[model samples]
Target: MAYLGVDIGTSSSKGVLVDASGTVIATAVRAHTVSRPRPGHVEMDPEVWWREFRDITRELLSGHLGGPDAKGGAGPASGASGGSSPTGVGVGRPGPVAAVGISGMGPCVALADGASRPLRPAVLYGVDTRAVAQIARLDAELGRPAVLDRCGSVLSTQAVGPKVAWVAEHEPEVFAAARRLFMPSSFLVHRLTGAYVLDHHAASQSVPFYDTGAEDWYRPWVDAVWPHMELPELRWPGDRAGTVTAKAAAATGLAPGTPVLTGTVDAWAEAVSVGATRPGDLMLMYGTTMFLIATVTRQLRVPELWSTVGAYSGTRSLAGGMATSGAVTEWLRGLFGAADRAVLLAEAEQSGVGARGLAMLPYFAGERTPIADPDARGVIAGLTLEHTRGDLYRAALEATAHGVRHNVEAMRRAGAAIERVVAVGGGTRGGLWTRIVSDVTGLPQDIPTVTVGAAYGAARLAAAHLEGEAATAAWNPVRDRCVPDPAAGAAYDGLHRLYRELYPATRDTVHALARLRREAAGTEDAASGGAPS
Candidate 1:
């Protein structure tokens, strides 16, 4: 039997089929778009996500349906013990997916009916900054100390609580109609099994409403934020959320009553995929955003980083994220009007490390974790007329690395003993980018050969659970590792100090400019009879 893992990402949905021995048999990916109707707002239609998921599943499962072991070598597509392939639920049939697991990009919250269909477009995590007002309200109501103690970090627009408050105040129609609220993974699980449940890893994003130390929901914060909304029952990753219902089976071409495991946030699953599961294992996700999840034995509350319950039970993790990573690269590429991504990458590599002394702050999408500021803006310092596009691109890459250093230092302050870094995501494929991050951070980075991020990890999780082995033991896979060059490290050590000063030195300046820009935009919107939602 094989296990299926699905990842609901911000820009796409990817799936992987893994065998008991950890070999991936099939992989599928489907892309979708994020809409930005107004500045600082990002949204996606939920129905679009559901449709893409259906298409990809059918595409992956169709070939194996009629197998005579369907090896694609001798005969037509027929099952090993098949008579034109049995369509109904049975062992070895395409219908009975042994076990299924899920992962998603999160800190997002969506309202769903009792049936689990989203009542409105999901308020995306990190990308959407409409909850700034709500965050201020939450900060005032909960008091700084209470929020910091409970959440291990100050409240920010990125947290789910503020998003919930946004829905309550702005879109009261959808908020009033909501039966329950859930993050991305929980929403996916609900659609699969008709159950409203959440995994603890994703639940951490809902803080101020969850107690990381107690590993349970904190009632007081919930009452203060929204007295009427009900939070879902939470479980650790790999626990059972529910069985596949008839409707879900029909929708996704799976068997009825299939086991569905409660899953985790995409970053946690990415950690699993990279073999960063044990204490001191650090998983660094390089994607639209930069996320660092380090496994540790104890929960810590640091000034900048967040300490949260780990994906698995009886452990803890220190989490930090930068609002933009690869996204900044994409933005710069567009500004440069590069013909293709390959062109940009090729130029970036040839430009060499440190971007030829160009420095970029990579705060284009605001900042999260370590310092929860939504008004933060990107800055390009040390640019000169002689700088080529390649130098600028390389600078953009190093800026992200510098951001990684900041997060790692914050995690260290939280008492996380991060010795090794396992890097995953499409960005890692850029050789120079990976090496620069290693050089900047002074840490060895392990790069797996088959790095598909969260979806691949979710499949591994499913394989372990279905095969009845210790899920943790069964999911470890190692490939190549990158060690830091001492000479480059010394250079970056000085550069990092300069990188650290750039944020504080220019934060207020950027804020002042951002205020002016927003005021001018608001005036235009008022003249135009208000902005779109």
Candidate 2:
């Protein structure tokens, strides 16, 4: 029987079907829009996500994934009986998707009623920082070290508990209405089955609600922070949550009664997709934002970066986030008025190593990871008329690399022993983008054969949890590896030094300016007794 993996990403949701032997049989995608009604606020209708999943699942089951090059219905590399290559394989395999696994962007808190209907739009993970005030309040009340010792790090806007606290403080109505607080996967699983479960990786960041050391919920801590809300049951990522309900089956085109495995965060699933299970293997996810996750033997707590429970059981991970990476690249692409990615890539390649002396600080979406500053803004310097679109494009790429360097250095400082990186996102599709990152960081990267991101990884996790089997053998293999050029590496080292200086030189100044602006807004709000914060 084949396993189905679903990834509920920030910008889209994708599903993939893989056999027990790790061969991808079918793949389908459904895109959704992120609504930004106000500055710094992002949301999505939970129903929209369900619809996308339904469409994608139906598309895949209807033979859309069985291209001409695919194995004659049996899927690639899966040995059929007698090695005869079974015909009409995919045609009859839709109903028997052995297990379903899911993963998505997280560290988010979704407020839901007892029946699992989302009370309000999900308070997104790092993408939405509306919990800043709540983060400050929790840190003050819980003590920084107190939380770090228990949950692996101090609570931030990214933490679910803080977002929960935000609801309690700002929207008490929503808080009172919500019977359960969950993550993306938790909400999805509730829809699939009647279960209210959260996987370990997602649960660990639930701050104060979970005790990482004990690997269970901390009742006292939960009472201390959020006495009003109910936390969900926690389980391993691949553990079966429940069988898909009849209603869910009709909505998603999935078979009724199919087992649904506990889900994980999207970045963790991406890590599994590219064989990044080994200790010290880093996963660089380049999607809406760049998230760096490294699997470590034990958890490491560092102030700047976040240390969380690993995606899979029996391991730990050091994760970091950069507010901008691919976003900046895409933004610059629009600025250049480029018609296609090929032309942009070609232009970026034409420029020299340092983008002809142009440098950029990629804080377009406000920094995360090392700095954790949401107020930070993007900056481009050293631009001149002498520069071309090629130079500007290359600079944008280099800026992203610079951000990665910053994150890597932070992880090193935190005692994360990362030596190899497995690149597993859409960014790896661009040869120049991959090389630039490799050169800038001086780290070789491995790209998997399919690079299906979180969805494929979730499928692998589901495959690993079969009745009885070896986890590693059931997954696909890595295909390509990119190494840094010695010459380019040397050039990037010099640029990286300059990149490091940019933050320190500008941070204090930026903070001061931001404070003044906030004060002015606050003063206006005080006068009106109505203006929103």
Candidate 3:
């Protein structure tokens, strides 16, 4: 039998079909972009996710069945299969789908009406910093010390509590009509199985709304924030959410009674993709943003970092994220008019460790974890006319490396035993970024065979639910490791010290600039005769 796994990401939606033996049989992707109507407001219509999921599933199934006409055009189970296709026409039959799994970028806020229809574009996680005022107000009202003790995290742009508060205060009409909250994963589950459920791991990230100690929604806090809204029933990441309904089966071409597993956020799913869930294991995901998840034996609280429930039950994690990582690289590529990544990567490699006396702060989208400064702006120091795009690109890589080091130190300080670092995502395709991170942090990184990321992880979770533990391990394995160089590590030690000091030195000035930009945006919106876009 085969399993289907799909992940709705910030940039694209991907689907993978894997067999019982843990081999990928078919894969498909649909690229999409987010809406940046105003600065610091990243969002996307929920309708886009469903459309892409339908498209990717059809493409993957068509590839597996040899053509769209196979099995009387019922479609090849889409994201549900593994290994090479069996040698025969009967292999295209529709009954091979054993289980379905899904995941998405989350801790997002998608307020829905009673019928589960989205009221507005989903406000994305952490990267959307429009809730700064709400974060401060919530922290003050809830008591910072109490929030840290109960919720396991401080109120920042990352928290769902403040985002909900922002909606209630700013858009009272929409807030009044909202009845249910959904993230990408839960939204998909609701559509497919007619079940309104959320995974515990995702719930933990909804700071002040969920109590990590109790492993359930903190009702008192929920009442204080959004009293009228009803919460989804909580389930573990691997638990079965519900069976697919006939209506959903007709839309997606899957069997009507197929089981669908409740899934968690993309980072945790990425961690599961490479078996990085053990105690002391850390998963460093390099994508649009840089995310670190360090699996720990117990829940440890640090204001600088996020402490949350792990993908599995009875485990904990200390997580940190940079607002931007590969995004900075992409920005440079656009500015330099380069069509491919190889050109930029090759140039950065030749520019060497120091980037020819250039230093950069990768805060182009403000800062997350360890700093939590939503007003922070990107800064480039020590630039001269002699410096080329190569030097600037190298400095950007180094800056992200320094940010990783800063997060690692914070995790260690909070008692997370980071024994092994597993690196995954599109950024790991080129060796330079991984090597730079290792040299800077003095840590070794293990690269897995399948870096397809969260989609693959969702498949694994599906396999585990149907065939048990053995099915998960056979799917992905560590293929290589990047070890630290002693000399390069020494050089980075001094540079990291400077990186730490640079932020504080320029904070006040950067904050002033951020205020000015917001003022200008407000005026423009007022002139346009609407709210801040």
Candidate 4:
């Protein structure tokens, strides 16, 4: 039987069907964007996630549910399977689904009522910096050392607790009725099986609410943050959450009583997709926002980086994420009105090394990890009037590379041994961005065969659930490696020094501007923005 995997991402929802042998039978994606209500406030309607999920699932499983052996060249519509195999039959034919895996962009705060109805729009992850004040207040209230010891990381914009506090303090009406908490993955799982559970990796990002050392929720801290809220049960990313219910089956076409595996954040799932589970293994996800997940031997705690339970039980991770990677590039693409992304990439390549002596800081959505500054704004330095769009685009690419190097240095300082880097996600599709990152960091990245990302990883996990540990062992293999050019590396080392200095040099001005914007806020139009989620 084939496994079904679905991931609700920031910009879209993607679904995949994979056979027991790890061959991708079919893949599907539904494109959408997040909402920017006000400055630093990024949100999305929870219903949109479920709606897109339903659409993607039906599309993946579409075809006549007939006998596989009785088929007379049964291939119809738009789906994945055709040939008959021992594990699964092709799409239009009767291919029994073995299990389901779910993942999403997290650790988001999707507050719901007792009945699991979302009270308001789900507040996004680190990129949404509306809870800066709450972060400071919580750090003071809980004590920084106590928090770091319990949570394995200090309070920051990425912490779910602070965002929940923001809602309690600001939107009291919604907070008053909220009794259940859900991130994207947990929300989807709950909808599927009525299982009130979340994976340990996502739970750890809730900061004060989760005790990393104990590997469970710290009830006292949870009560302190938002009184009387019922938290979901915690499990490993691959653990079986529950069987799909009849209602959920009817809504999504997934078989009733089918097992649904617990899933963590999207980045972690993508990391799993490339088999980056061993210590010293780092997974670089090149998506809307670049994510770096370094699997470490032990939990490396530092204020600059996030230390959370890895996707699996025995493993641990020290991770860092850029606030905006492709997001900045996409914004620039929109401004330039470049009809095709390939054209922009080609232009950026022609612009070359230093982007015609221009430099950029890709903090359009504010910085996360290492610098963790929400007020940080995007900057373009040394831009002359004659600088072309190609030059600006090249600078943006280099800027992300610089940011990545900064995070890598922080991970090293935290004692993470990053030996092998596996690159995954949509950004890896273009060689130019990966080349720039390799040159900037001086680290070789292993690119896998199936880069469809989280959904594929989810499918792998589901395969493991059915066939035991051996099922996921030989899945996605590395096909190519992006190595650094020593000549380009030497030049980037010098430019990176300048990139680091640029942020601190302009922080004060950006903070002042950010404050002014907040003071003068309130807009009727909700702008649909950001790269991919």
Candidate 5:
């Protein structure tokens, strides 16, 4: 039998189908973009998620994922003979779809009416800094220390509580009708099985809304900020939410009663994809934003890091994220005429250490960790007329590497035991970025055999739901390792110092410029939140 996994990402939605032997049957992607309605506001129509999911499911169903014809066709990869699983779900044969797993970029604010109708476009994660005012207000009202002590994370742009409050304060109409909240995975779960549930990991990011110690919604705090809204029921990322409803089955070609797992944020799911769940294990996700998740036994609340429940039950995580990483390189690529990425990677490698004496700050979309400054802006320093596009690209990559190191240092300071580092995501594909990160941070990274990312992890979760977790543990193994170069690292040591200094030096100037730009654009308002301390 086959399992299907789908992930809704910032830029696209991807679906993957795999068989019992952990072989990929087929994959599909639907590219899309988020809407920037106003400065500091990032959103997407929630309908797009379901639409792309439906389209991707149709495409994957028509691919290598096959069953039997009259018994319901099989894809070309269906080699296993007919059989049944312990759940009697028809694992090896009859059921074309053993289980379905869903994940997506989160913790987001997707509010819906009582009937599951979206009230407005979904407010995205940290990149959407529109909730700054709400963050500050809530922190002052609720006491920042109490929040950190109970929530395991400070209220920042990443927290879901503030965004919900932002709605209640700014868009009262939307709040008046808001009854259900969701991230992409839970949103899909609601669509597929009519279940109002969210993974504990995602809920924890709701910050102050969920109490880490209690492992449940902190009812008093949640009610204080977001009164009268029905939250999704909590479950582990891999726990079974429900089965496919007949209505959903007809819409997506999934058989009626196909099991569905409660999925999680893309980064955690991506961590599962590469088997980075043990204590001291770090999963570095390189994508539009650079995310770092460190699996830990202790739940420490560091002001600079996000502490949350792990994707699996009885597990905990300390995480950090950069506002942008590959995004900076992609931005540079566009300015340089969108050069072929492979060719650019080659050129960047030739640019060598220090990017020809250039240093940069990867704050194109503000920042999330170590320095949680929404007012922080990108800075390119020590540039010259002679600098080439490749040099600029190299500086961008080095800048992100510095950010990773900064976060790693904070994680270490917080007493997180980070022993193993595994790299995953599209950014890991080019090799140059991963090597640069390794060289700059002095951390050797294990490259897994399968790096299809969160969608693959979602598939892995689906497989684990059927065959048990251990089977999926060995499903993806390290194929290569990116070891740090002492010599190159020594050179980056200086550049990283310069990188760190450049931010503070430029902060005041950038903050003023940012406000001026907003004023000029006529979008600056009281609700347009300011920088966080």
Candidate 6:
């Protein structure tokens, strides 16, 4: 018995601790970052996600091998004799944790009040393109084909209803002391089970306030987009969302009531940590933005992908994302200072393939799914002084492999039968950005064996909801494969047709330099008396 998992990502926060035969045992991370306050604003401060989930659950219950005793008591229970170790890892004795999962990087909003707190900093997700005029005034007063026929997705900047109507039309006193709404795994499951709930795959990416064929919450598009908030209870990212609250067990040493689970979003827990949840599978991931998901069986609506529901519960997905992959090679290894990432992945693998003539467009942070352009910028078409920083980090890894071959050709033009891809996060570790996204999506990936993503798929959805077991393909498998080369297919099919014609050949000069950088960040937030956030 062990479990526990965590996520929250978009720069970092992880956690793990598997066991009960599915291995892993301990892991932790925290990192942090994300608060581009203005230019297409991105944020973070749900109290830095419960202070990095209580500093990664007190460094994975205080590691050094022996487990869970420092303060997280309760040991030994479910099928008693722990297991694993012939290199699968978990060497026994971390007994009884039995649940607590979570995930994040989401269709985020995180309003809160009525004591849940946070009312300002949290409008992230879909790379926060500051709600493009509340996604065109909620697609012109909720219509765009009745919101892609009842929220299979359409209002874009990836929905949460135009960032809660850009905070009820620009922070009406934090939307009049907002009532509640959270993401980042239901704001850490409403701070460890004070439970305000939310999980049906992050409420089906909170589009026209969720309805994906009536799976729930559409109340006339939440009474025309958040009529004074209050709406969480959804639950299904492996159910059981309650337990663990003696003030979150003294700020996270587990025990007080244990059980937690309702988690989703971290690319559907990295597509349930790579079992890629069936029906034609897909799950790309490759983090700090470049997700894919797929797993369909129905509901394949495609205003260029994102059809939600399916973190288990009959299943259905289609998703796509790419507001930047490996964040444009960590912004060309922080503009070539290169102190890490194996020295810019060994100088972008000797700057080969097309990076020589370059053609990037990872859209820095202003594009998602098929071309849900959020003032889409980041172009970089061919450059000079004879290119280097290894051809601009191999043209930002072949412009995130031509934005994953234009989102796998918009998930095969919405029909979505994407056989089987896999690939998981931390940019699928080296191997030249998964062999340039398999020679620019000629397809063929796989690579699993515990990518430790979405905190090991939220500890395999808390070991399949407290040990009923399907521990994600027996705790992760398919160790390697990347295939597709065929002589680099005519140079990634002519650089994916100029990365699909470099976004309408530079969308009106990056939307007029994103409206003069949002009017110089709203005149430096009105000379610092702050406002445009």
| List of clashing residue pairs for candidate 2 | 104-266
In candidate 1, stretches whose alpha carbon ends up further than 4 angstroms from where it belongs are 65-96, 469-476, 523-533
Report the error of model 6 at residue 101, Å.
2.5
Please, what are the lDDT tens digits per residue for candidate 6 over residues 1-533?
Answer: 67878888878777788876667877766666877867777888888878677766655665523435444432221111112111112344577677888888888888888888887888788888777766776678878878888778887777888788777876788888898888888888878878888888788888888897878888777878777777878869888888898888776667788888888888888888878888998888887788888888899786777888888888888888888888777877887675588877787788888878888888877787787877778889879887878778888888888888888887887788888899888888877989888888888998987798887888788877765654445778888999988888677897788788778877887777767777766733311211112
Per-residue CA lDDT of model 3 for 256-327, tens digit only, reads 898999998999999999999999999999998999999999999989999999999999999999999988
The pairs that clash in candidate 6 are: none
User: Lowest summed lDDT over 10 consecutive residues: which window, candidate 6?
Assistant: 78-87
User: Residue 445 of model 4: what lDDT?
Assistant: 95
* lDDT against the true structure, each candidate: 0.75, 0.75, 0.86, 0.85, 0.86, 0.77
Writing each residue's lDDT as its tens digit, candidate 1 over 1-533 gives 66788888876778776666666667667666677765667777666556555555554565444422223221222221212222221223333368888888787777776566689888788667767777666778888778778776566655788777777877788877776777667777888887778888777768678887677888888888777767788887788888889887777776789888888889998987867878989998988888999899887877477777787788788888888888888877878874487777788888776677877888886787666676678999988888888888888889999999888888887778997789999888857788889999988998887788898788777766666546546454667888888998998888888888898899878777766666766622211211111
Candidates by lDDT, descending order: 5, 3, 4, 6, 2, 1
For residues 124-161, could you state the per-residue lDDT of candidate 2 as single tens digits?
77666666666776778888898888888777656777
Model 4 agreement with the true structure over 198-260: per-residue lDDT tens digits: 999999998889999989999999999888899888899999999999998877777799999
Give TM-scores for every candidate, taking all chains together and pairing residue i with residue i: 0.90, 0.89, 0.93, 0.93, 0.94, 0.37
Best by lDDT: 5
Stretches of model 4 off by over 4 angstroms after superposition:
63-94, 522-533
Higher-ranked by lDDT: 3 or 6:
3
Select the stronger candidate by TM-score from 2 and 5: 5
Compared to the true structure, candidate 6 yields what TM-score?
0.37
Residue-pair clashes per candidate, as listed? 10, 1, 4, 6, 7, 0
Error of 5 at 327 (Å): 1.4
Candidate 1: the clashing residue pairs are 66-78, 66-79, 67-78, 67-79, 67-80, 68-78, 68-79, 68-80, 69-79, 69-80
Q: Write the per-residue lDDT of candidate 5 for residues 1-533, one digit (tens) a residue.
A: 88899999988888888787777767777777889888888999898898777767755664444422322322322211122111101122323889999999998999999999999999999999877878888989999998999999999989999889989988999898998898899989999999999999999999879998889998898799777878778999999999999988767778889999999999999999999999999999999899999999989888899999999889999999998888888888888887999988898889999889888899998899989998889998889999998899888988999999999999999989989999999998979999999999999999998788999899999999989987776788799999999999998888778888888889889888878878887867633556854
What is residue 236's positional error in candidate 6, in angstroms? Answer: 25
The regions of model 2 sitting more than 4 angstroms off are: 64-95, 467-474, 512-533
